[model samples]
Target chain A: MKSVLCILFTFGLWLLLTWSLDPKVVGVGLMMAILVATLLAHIYPDNPHKALDPRRWFWACIYFPYFLVLCIKSNLDVAYRVLHPDLPIRPGIVKIRTRLTSEMAKTFLANSITLTPGTMTVDIVGQDLYIHWINVHGVDAEEHTRRIVRPFEGLLRRVFE
Target chain B: MSETIAQWIIGVGLMFDLLGCLGLVRLPDVYNRLQAGTKCVTLGTCMIMFGTFLYGVAALDRPQMAVQALLCAVFVLLTSPVAAHAIARGAYRAGARLWEGSVIDRLGEDLHGVRPPAERAEPADQPAAVHHFTESES
Candidate 1:
């Protein structure tokens, strides 16, 4: 099942990249997709069936626009700091705990954190993620988690978990 | 009209790219630089790609070029953060010092068994070998 999913994904990518409907191009793409998918199927998530859920896809589609707004806001914030004469920054690495158990969800969470606001994920130690904040606001870990991780956690959980 | 819109979008993207480069120069440390460079540049490049897509489709009437541009934009969006995360992790493990203005060092504290220290105190710069605990435990 995982192999089948992988083949479909790879072949879709190949078609998109090639942007062709020619029979020869498709035939070669399928063969290559199968070969690659067979070699890489083991790395697929434990529950590949979750990918088929329409609800997950819906949330993912929603995530894009939401994420874009946040990304723009963050870019503006960074721009402000960069252009300021004082370079107003109080950088720090703070730890925040995540309730996400699945590796894929955790990865999405980490990537989202990196792109949003003034925070970047430096390292993930199990449930504890060390984030480098451009402006360290508060000392408490729970508060950091609330401010940094909570916004995306519920949405991501619905999408990946 | 479409060409004008695409040009404006691309122009905005160029401004963002310039700011990101400025950040690379102005930021005080490796981590902060990574933050600025990655976020601004990734968004900037994606916007440029998006403008190209619009111009190709609407202005030039080239579906192929538009599709390719859209694909490039998506590819950048997906991959840039992953690359930034890897670089940040590697820099930390390699013992890159945080800027003196940094207020906390939780990773250092976790590894060295110490609390957050005084503002100017530097963490002992041990080799990466000493920080194998993350890999071993996981």
Candidate 2:
């Protein structure tokens, strides 16, 4: 059932790209989508058989808008820092802790931090993530973690975990 | 009007890309440089691609071109952070020294086996063993 949905989604993407009423294009798209689903789907780390829930989808939808706002705000913030005469950056690597256990969730968290402007996940050791922050307001790890990691944690919990 | 909107979007993207480039030059070290290179460039490129997609869909009415732009944006979105991760890990492994202003060295404490090459001098307590550089060490 999951694989079928995956194939259908891929085929839908193909159709969207092609925008053709021709039956031949669809036949090719289906063939390609099936081939991809069969060959590559298992390579994805997450369980392909698990049913996707609408609740998760809802959280994801919420997450995207939040992320979009963060992206814009961060871009503007970084631009200001770049343009400032003092270049007001206090760069450092700070450690953070996360409750996320799955590799996919961890990757998502890392990618989110990297994209959000002032922070980048530099390394991960066990539950600890080393972040390279553009501005270091405080040396306390807990304080920095609260500032950096807490914002995205709840949404990610709902979405990935 | 659509053309003007596309131009403005593209203009914003160009400004971001330019700021990112300035960040690359102005930042102090490899990690700091990666911060600029990764975040700004990814956002800038994604915005540019998005603008191209908008232009195609709104102005040219070309679904295929818009899809192409979307695919580029998605591709950049997926790959950029992974690339940044790989580069950061490599730099840390290669013992790319941190900025003098850097507050902490967490990797130094966490990974006992991997030491910065400069700090790899044999300890006096351990009998000096002939060491061959592993692939990662080199």
Candidate 3:
């Protein structure tokens, strides 16, 4: 099942990248995708059936636009800080816990945090993520988790977990 | 009309790129610099690619160019954060210090085994740690 999913994914990527529908091109793409999937499918550890869930796809679609808006807002915030004279930064590394158990979900969470407002993930030790915040408003782990992780965690849980 | 819109978007993107470079110069330390540089540049470059896609589709009438440009934008979005995270991790592991005005250093504390007692107590439901042994130890 995983192999089939991998093959389909790889072939879909090939089609998108090539943007061609010619039979010869498609045949070659299918062959390559099969070969790659056979070699790489083992690395995909999650239940392959999860990838077929329509609800996850719906959330993922929602996530992209939501993330874009957040990205733009954060960029403007960063721009303000960059252009300001006093700099106004109170940077710090704080540890926050994540409810995400899977490695893939944790990775997505980390990447999202890095790209989001005023935070960059410095390290992930067990369930705790060490984040560098440009503006340190709080000290405690629960406070940091509430402010930093809460926003994305629900959405990510629906999509990945 | 589309050409003008694309030009404006590309212009704004260029301005963002400039600010990100300024950030690289102005920020205090490695972590701060990475934050500014990575976030700003990633968005800036992705916006530029988006502009290119619009230009290709409407101005040049080339769907292929538009698709490729959009793909580039997506690629940048997916990869930039990962790259930034790796750099941050590497810098920390390499002993790069945070800025003087920094308020905390949880990662450093964790690495040095100086975490507060409250944090040291693990929940009973938490999974057991995995240990790996080298040839000699084994």
Which regions in candidate 1 have their CA more than 4 angstroms from the true location? A21-28, B115-138
Q: What ranking emerges by DockQ with the best candidate at the front?
A: 1, 3, 2
**Best candidate (score: lDDT):** 1
lDDT of 3 by residue, A65-122 (tens): 9888888888898899999987888888999999998877898999899988999998
Question: Which model scores highest in DockQ?
Answer: 1
**Candidate 3 runs further than 4 Å off:** A19-39, B115-138
Over B63-106, each residue of candidate 1 has an lDDT whose tens digit, in order, gives 98999899999889889999999999998877777776678888
Candidate 2: tens digits of C-alpha lDDT, residues A1-161:
55676698789888877878698999999999999889877656566433378888899999998987887777787788878877787776778899888787888999899888688888887788988887887768798889998989899988887
Summing lDDT over every window of 10 consecutive residues in candidate 1 chain A, give the lowest-scoring window.
A42-51
Task: Please rank every candidate by TM-score, starting with the best.
Answer: 1, 3, 2
Q: Supply the DockQ value of model 1.
A: 0.72
The segments of candidate 2 whose C-alpha lies over 4 angstroms from its true place after superposition are A1-42, A49-51, B112-138
Query: In the order shown, what is each candidate's alpha-carbon RMSD?
Result: 5.5, 6.0, 9.0
Q: What is the alpha-carbon lDDT for the whole of candidate 1?
A: 0.89
lDDT of 3 by residue, B70-121 (tens): 9889889889999999899998786666666677778878786685534433
Worst 10-residue lDDT window for candidate 2 chain A reads A42-51
Worst 10 residues of 3 chain B by lDDT: B129-138
